[model samples]
Target: MAKGYIEFDYEFCKGCELCIQACPVNTLVLTTKMNKKGYRLVEDAEGKCTGCASCALVCPDAVITVYRQKKAS
Candidate 1:
């Protein structure tokens, strides 16, 4: 089975951990590496999300976008 979710734009991210904490299902994690602006980027933790948009709503940078997979028949 494959997992689905949003992908973050690391370059635009400000290392703000709001997305990581905002996730309802504990799906997101922050990376140690910094972006062009020396900010940490958020990464998905492989199949933990419930496709909720909490993080996207709270993100000031608007770098986060959630993509949900269709249910199998």
Candidate 2:
């Protein structure tokens, strides 16, 4: 299972690739498909996301929400 996952608000997102660049785990990428606004959507690539919030921090549109699983102690 992935350590974390991100949810994107495609309608609010501007399709900026800043989130993709900000992801330390390289979990995000810009897809060819467009959102309702006709902007290319950012999607999660196949990878392990560490839930660092880097993508959320860099997003100007505040479109990304991250969910992380708690590690077993």
Task: Kindly list the per-residue Cα lDDT of model 1 for residues 4-51, writing each as its tens digit.
Answer: 578777788887788888877787877687888887777886568766
Once superposed on the true structure, which residue ranges of model 2 sit more than 4 Å away at CA? none
Where does model 1 exceed 4 Å of error? 1-3, 71-73
Give the Å error, residue 14, model 1. 0.5
Pairs that clash in candidate 2? none
Score every model by TM-score: 0.80, 0.88
lDDT (10s digit) by residue, model 2, range 17-46: 999898887878788989888999988877
Could you tell me the TM-score of candidate 1?
A: 0.80
Candidate 1 at 46: error in angstroms? 3.8
